[model samples]
Target: MTGKTVVITGASSGIGRQAATELADRGARIAVVGRHRARAEAVAAEVGGVAFIADFDRLDDVRTLADDLLFACDRIDVLANNAGGLVPTRTLTVDGHERTFQSNHLAPFLLTQLLLPRLIESGARVISTASVANRWARLRLDDLNWAQRPWLGGWGAYGTSKLETILFTEELARRTAGTGVSAYSFHPGFVATSFGHGSPLMALIALMSGGRYGISVEAGAVPLIELASTLDPGFPSGTYFDTLTGNGRRHRLAGDADLAAALWQRSAELVGCVPAR
Candidate 1:
């Protein structure tokens, strides 16, 4: 990993933060991204890397962050779209999209699209963090913005967004099929982190799950690190992985290629980016 330039969003805490530290320790150049400038800078300082502050709540900030990151690095060897959380309330972003959906799905979708040229040029890999919760999601594609009927709670919204993440990864991999760059989504396992801090219900669930179900952040990051640095050029793309347990562990719904393709089309429309042919 020495000398490789890697960009990670949500690096201020959780699995992203742990991955940044581990990768930087291996001599990789890190770009730490977070909503809070101070926290982002602190992580950057700890890893001897650069800091980028941008709130995922706004679409314009997503574009600005992409541009700034491109300006900072000659090439991005790896991009971990790890900045995301579940908002229990039905809040609308400045762009008028539901907060949870926009943050967890659209933000990464747009960022990845904007950075595709650079990723292609540098032969970079893209890794997105999804969750096992995708299985329970009942996707309402017709009312994705939640204007027709508001989300009942935050957990449902979060699960829907994660399902979209898996779909996006599948379609993105198909589009980049023959290219050196690959796209993958994975469940980091349940980790003890601040991921649930935004919602009390989530925090309670995390607390109750306790240390047994929740692994260390470092342990959760193992698959991410492997996906980033693996030398296997022939590794499969568009696959969902779960901590070495193989395919069966993933939600059956997550593997629906038809739904995945539709979600990809919708995401491209939402982000205003043309999907790579």
Candidate 2:
């Protein structure tokens, strides 16, 4: 990764933070993006890179972040759309979208779309942090905001958002075909991070896994590091990686080609960007 420029969201902590450190050690220029200014700058200094602050809850912040990156880096070889959290309730963002759905999917979708041109030019890899919980998504394209069916604790909402991310990856890779850009998604293996706070679903997982509940933060970051650092992992663009499943396996419901296309167009409309197709 020497001489490569990598931009990682949610780098202030958890899997993203570990990847930023490891990638920086490998001689890449790190653009540490986080919601918190102090933590972002601290991580940037720790990695000898620059810090960018953007609240994923706001679309404007994401747009401004893209502009900042375009001006700060000559090329972006890797974009880790790893910034997200479990909202624990059916809440709304300032943008009037479901908080979990927006933060975990729409915001990153906007960021990726904004950077698509630069990524294609640099032959970059776009990596999204998805989850095994995607199986429980029960995704409804018409109910992306969960207004029709409510999951008050945010677990189901998180699942749907994750499913959306994988679908987004599929459409993204298809659109960027032959454009020298690749998109990958992966499950980070239930890392015991600051995420999922106050969610009963996560609590149940802890009980089910017993003593082996969650992996260490560093352990969870391995797959992300693999995809971001190199073009390896042996999976084609839009493929998803999960350690428990065969390589490139994703959720059963996450393979809808038509849905992926609809999602791309809908997301483009939501974020006010022209779909690259």
Candidate 3:
């Protein structure tokens, strides 16, 4: 990984932070992105890397971050779309989309599309952080906004968005074939990170687990690092992994080629970006 440039979102803390530090120590040039500029700068300084600030809730922020990255780095070896969260309520962004949908799926979708050319030139690897919770997703492809259905907290919405994340990886890998860019999605296991801001249950779990039952941030980040660094022979693309166990599968919907294609088109339309050919 030496001399390679890696960009990781959500690097202010948790798995993102662990991955950023570890990658930097291995001599990869790191760009740490966070919602908070101060936190991002702190992490960047620690790793002797650069910092970028972008809020996933806003598409404009994602666009600006892409522009900044393109201007600063000529090549990106690894792009880890690791930033995501679960909103407790059904909130909407200025883009008029559900908050979880925009943050988890659309933001990274746009970022990857914007950087496609560069990723192709560098033969980059794209890694999206998915979770086992995707099994909870009951995809409403017809009503992605959830406006038609009554609010049921935000877990359903969050899971659905993650399902989209996996689908996006599948579509991306398919589209970028022979372009030297590959995509991967993986479940990081039950990580002891500060995720899920709106739910009391998440807070309780974080507190009670105290990093006991849950895996440490370092352990949780191994899968991401491996995917970014290695391209083993016959390694599958457009696939979801259980963890670092050398094999994993996604939910049934996530593996549907037709659905992945449709979601890719829908997502491109929603984000107002052309899907990479």
Task: Please tell me which predicted candidate would have the highest TM-score against the true structure.
Answer: 3
Looking at model 1, the pairs that clash are none
- Lowest lDDT 10-residue stretch of candidate 1: 243-252
What would the per-residue lDDT of candidate 3 be over residues 13-82, giving only the tens digit for each residue?
9999999999988899999999999999999999999999999989999999999999999999999999
- Report the C-alpha lDDT of model 2 over 1-277, residue by residue, as the tens digit: 9999999999999999999999999999999999999999999999999999999989999999999999998899999999998888787889989888899999999999888889988999999999888888878778889998867687788888888889998899898999989888899897887778778877787779773667898889998898887656566788888842424455676778998998888888887788445
Sum up the clashes in candidate 1. 0
The CA lDDT of each predicted structure is 0.84, 0.87, 0.87
Ranking of predictions according to TM-score: 3, 2, 1
The C-alpha stretches of model 3 lying farther than 4 A from their native spots are: 206-213, 275-277
Cα deviation of 49, candidate 3, in Å: 0.7
State how far residue 36 of model 2 sits from its true place (Å).
0.6
What's the alpha carbon RMSD for model 3?
1.9
* Candidate 1 local Cα displacement, residue 106, angstroms: 0.4
For each candidate in turn, the TM-score is 0.92, 0.94, 0.95
- The TM-score measured for candidate 3 stands at 0.95
RMSD of each: 2.3, 2.1, 1.9
